[model samples]
Target: MERIRRLLQRKTLYEPLEGGSESPDGEPIPHSKQQPFSWLDYSVFLLLGVAMLWAWNMFLAAGPYFQRRFESDDRLLRNFQSAELSVSTVGNLGSMILLTKLQARASYPKRIVASLVLNIVVFTLLAVSTRLFLGVTASVYFAFLMLVVFSASLATGLCQNGVFAFVSGFGREEYTQGIMTGQGVAGVLPCIAQIVSVLSVPEKKSEQGAPLESSTSAFAYFLTASVVSTVTLAAFAFLLSRHSPRQRIKRSLDSEDSENDPERFVRKSVPLVRLLKKLFWLAGAVFLTFAVTMMFPVFTQQIQSVRDPHSAPRLFQPASFIPFAFLLWNIGDLIGRVSPAIPGLTLTSKPRLLFILSISRVIFIPMYLLCNLRGKGATISSDVFYLLVVQLLFGLSNGYIGSNCMMGFVEWVDEDEREAAGGFMSLCLVAGLTVGSFLSFFAAGSS
Candidate 1:
């Protein structure tokens, strides 16, 4: 038992957490007194980069195909399927939260490494298999595809949760923003890939009445994704090996820690009731954001449907909004992430204020819808401009809202239940996203 405890208690990373005696202003430090991974930690950052690479390629390969394939489907089906996929992925987030909470208690690096490796393998398999088998139209193939998506979602959720947990243990609050930024960067690659596909014309049909077919360009996308994943896994393996050089926390220090310390324990365990309340509020915010953003997909689909009635539909590149608009949002978020240092930025600390501001777009969404419906009065450019402004505002609000979400829950809950609180909040956010997509499908049909 002593030997096992000693093995688990080793500290592998973080310079900032160890050097600072006082808490860094604004950054929440975990009770374990562990700091989050620092930028200096090459392995964590490298892993983040590799993950981002894989993420971008996977999106490139899969998103265009899915968008094109489903363009003509009933709005409700499109919405429902998208929501279902979102829900499955979000639900996996709950599992991730649980795992992180366990990691906090155990502090086992081996377990974390094993989980991460498994996630990579599972995700790679899903991406490769789904892309390759896409030509098969049988029910069996369809079921298999769905299964693969489910597995992919699980893998992604697991990876996200594990990273969050692992980073938190070291007291790294920046991990969240860093991860989000990585996601934003990864998005850029897919956008470029989609544009390239759009620019490439199909070969001219011969006079022999042969059907002109689109090349499987997306396969190159997925194949690139698989290679990125392979490289990421290799990097992770190397980083884990380097991890051993860092000093391990002595076993005596870990075993002595427990819930008996009232101040510490209370700080750690947030009440479940409080956590749920936070979820309801955050869910409402997410619902509002998703409701408006879901319009992007719907609008793209609508435009394509109108333009290509008889023509076999190809993927539309509205993913331009993802990299562009989402980049704007993330930049705002990055500002918020660093805002704790600025005196003025700290003024907007009220939970309700942030939440309301975040969801303010619910009012604007109706107007965008109204304009979109009044088609003859407004030019397409005018309508699109209006829509873009609304989205930008939405992104800005989200910048504040997403950060508030983490802060608000922390304020609401006592410290101990932080994991459960965060998990529940994530679950609600995901649910709202799923519901929003589902609603948008029907709403598009009506429009």
Candidate 2:
């Protein structure tokens, strides 16, 4: 009915929404003056999205740094990413399960705020730890690092569930996509930073025993992440205090949803068990989607350019190749995430197709294996172009398939069940990350 009134009002007052008409739920139609959300709202949520995922994405971008820190222990160096992600996913999964079971629409804002503070404190610790731990053994510092990873995962669980529930309850497709857009930004920035950190290592020193990313650079990078969280937290505090139009309206509507039809909402929600059952397919689809995605980086990080490192330019050397490839993959991801906002590009009413595509991403495993892995010989040699193109398409498909799965859940269940569905889906997504993180050990090992 709300969607209908918006359409009727649009036809009478304005010419028509671009893209002929709104495509479907989760579709990003062009905005006009009449829409409730403004540029300010979009900016806030975009930062929210970035701050929500920044910690882990920072870890992802700083894989080489972690590798360097653990270089003394070959086994630890090989498996630090897997272990860090393992702890993170476990922490995320546990917290999300608890948060989902303890549902209250009013708590969403609180969760986001709390999560932001947690992220800031944890990131600061991470930044400072890089330069400190002077006398500590590498293993002990690695333990501290994993603790940070675990704490960040807890924050991720809270923020992801809160942000999605807020967007879904607010019933705005564009704002959710704004978060998606910020996710693209989140993915890109860390990759760029990784490239910079790797490059900043002086050529002379890099050729020496210290081939790792600079500790100073890593310190600056992690500290910058902490500052980002501080800014996002301040922005959110302002949003709540200012009581913008969007917040005002959302509060009233949320109240109605909670207070007006308490019995109906309870009846609609049933139990968490039953609610999750209804979303088995949705959960499974997201599970498989991210399961495949999480496997990519661990293996791909080992891939080297086929160009002869001795003669090839610095940019093409093994050290630089890793970060540059990550940058390209993330750049492709940004493009793919934004593609759904465009009219013709969005995938709608295509769950089966999306699931099939999700499963099909497994093919990338062999594709990566075929590339010239550093220690492992390559079946596909002298073909850096092949690896680059594969990374691009890999990222594009991951973004497209994952976005459509998230958006189409509204169509998957009853109206009152939408909120519960959001939490369950968030849980499922993190569960996928956990499974994939563990599986990466075997995947990368095989490579």
Candidate 3:
């Protein structure tokens, strides 16, 4: 009973050690001071987030290329390609949930290193699978492809949880912001790579009589992804090395056993159920935000052209709109993620207002559905300018609102709870991605 009382007392008196403080043992406790924000911190967090999600974005960005690989008439293949993220998101969701429940001694840096190695292996295998199965039956090809995607998704889930958890340990919200910004870059970079790949391919006739297979470009992209994974692996190792004082402090703090720390006792005293309840609103807001935004990529690829393919500018041609829309969305998302840094613009202090704004995004669904994409005649969907505007809005809102919710959730929790909170937020975000991906099937059906 005395132990319980002490724990409760600690909980009640708990405050982050931003400055020096005395522990119950009458010893001075050093504050876990965060290093002043520097370009190195920004680069690490941003690149880490980007590296974690880059493969997933490549899967989505390569949809047009995948469509061209299969029989031209196979709408099912197109749908599957479009929904690949949802499929992997299932794996992602599962991994995060398991991480939340499991207690292991593995540190975030180790987890990240393992996840990066796994990603490199998975991406390399994915490239090989595409090449090896190119001549095989479609059934065999897609089966192998899906397996690879699931593996990548599972790796992504682990990496994302680790990255977020790792960054939260810094006790700075900007680290989280940098991760979100990196994710935006993840989405944009693949599209840019795809564009460059498409533009670089020499116009040549293939023996199969269709233009040269897009698989060539895809192979190069995956290979590039693998190389990037290696670079990230190196960067993380360097960052976590003892030479860096900031990381040394974090490693020491993170390595401390929970039983040895009074702060851990206070964190443990809070009921898990209460913490979850506190996080429910932010999670739901993220779910709805992503659920609506995901449908954009699903329908964008199928839209009928507003003008003749030959008449359009090279960049805005019918063949390019899908990637173009994706690129625009990502660029807007990057902008939105950064926008919160501006004074007077952050919604972190206003959860209810943020919730309302998130919910209001549903209006975009009906508006997008009404567009004349894939319709018999030119309509609002065919208007490149209009579609770009809507996509920009969609991406912007998703980034701004999602970043605010995540940052706020972390800030609301005790430092010890921040890692779990990040994992919980990831759970919600992946759930949203999964739900949205499933809904895209219905959207595809309607189209």
Candidate 4:
């Protein structure tokens, strides 16, 4: 037990520093005198972070299903994704700004709890709407679906901002890394659920051509998401409770932060733009990273498997190929997100290297485009192995560069500044997402 505790307590990679902190005013910042972080605390944070993005992932995983719903209407089905992303991104950005304006109370637990409850509601509505709207016009159904997307988007912004702010308040890079890692896992979960939902539910004949997927599988998918949210909600609620040992330790740190730097608790001009350099190009790096990643679920979903009928596995079939691809990318992303826990992997505080790396990720566009995309005979390679390699590298770079930028920025700032940095970082991230959502329109058109 002692050996395990010692191993888990190892120091995380941070900026090049001499184990000291300095405030903006040049005063030394003291380290926390709180209890040691236990394994349970790490698990709770990771799980809660996973829950934070669960709804969005599930929605993306259900994209093909949504297209199926619009099968009869060629126009709507063709452009449903573009419109859906627009609505969700608009809602996400607007809500994040609103929440930032109202975040003076630092009601982290309440914000997270409310968002989780909202997510459960949104997923439930998605599950029900598929069957309930079978008789309605496709346009009406798409409108209703967009509303659900907006709700989930709103919840996502709230939960993510809350989690980021809460973790940043403590100024612990390990916690931040853990939460980001959990988010990568969040991406992975829906892929598994998607496959399960598709395989478990029986398909029936459509009035038109081929068979259609049943809402039963979708119900199970959303239900699984609801259960995850429920479990994470309970866990977060307990962390806020006074009885939990972990909560007590964290609360002490929070109290100390408040007492030591009362100015941070009060709102002031954040100088968000001024922080561009101090943040070590994290804002721009994150912005570009996600903007490029806009290819995912949009352009990515278009990459059909090139199967060798003579020796292909069932997973390479049309029914399961997309989800399997999603799984591989997310698994690679999870690996990259967790890798920074090791020292020097991200080269903290090195802006030039990070910036170059971020810019270089644009090469993935050609890599993906050159694949047997759209089955349009523009192929550099038709090998499924080649496509898998591209996805793994794509996801790995996304997580590694993004995580390092944020982690490096967090480490470079003082504890007092971290709370502000947190909000700023999240803003940049969402800004990236919003731009990516718009860019995906052009990407889809070109493809």
Q: lDDT at 120 for candidate 1? A: 58
What is the Å distance of residue 442 in model 3 from its true position? Answer: 1.6
- The global Cα lDDT (0 to 1) of model 4 is 0.71
Residues 1-447, candidate 1, lDDT per residue (tens digit)?
998877665432222222111121211223334433446453454355346335424642455454444343445323435644455545555555565444223332333344445545655665465456555544444455466555555555555544443343334435444544444445445555555554466533323322222325555655566565566656555544443334233223433543354332233334546656755565455445545555544543333111222342443222232334333443443444444334455322365555576566566555445443423333343424543454445445554455445434434443344444544554444455556666676766776
Each candidate's number of clashing pairs is: 19, 0, 0, 0
Order the candidates by lDDT, highest first — what do you get? 2, 4, 3, 1
lDDT score for residue 119 of model 3:
86
| Candidate 1: segments with Cα more than 4 A from true spot | 1-37, 41-119, 126-135, 200-216, 227-247, 252-271, 277-292, 303-348, 370-388, 407-415
The C-alpha TM-scores of every prediction are 0.65, 0.84, 0.83, 0.83
For model 3, the local distance difference test gives 0.69
* Candidate 2 structure, TM-score to reference: 0.84
> Residue 446's C-alpha lDDT in candidate 1?
72
lDDT of model number 1? 0.45
Candidate 1 structure, TM-score to reference: 0.65
Rate residue 427 of model 2 by lDDT.
81
User: Compared with the true structure, what per-residue lDDT tens digits does model 4 show for residues 1-447?
Assistant: 998877665433322221122222322223343535556767778997798777778777766667678888988877787787888888988888777666444555566777899988888777777567678888888888888888888888888777776666445567777888998999998888777666665544445433355666567667777888899988876654422444345445667675786443344435555566677477788888888887776656777666653466656654567777888889888888898888868565686687788889888887778765765544655655545668888899888887787666766665445655776777678888899888877787888
Higher-lDDT candidate of 1 and 2: 2
Cα lDDT for residue 290, model 3? 82
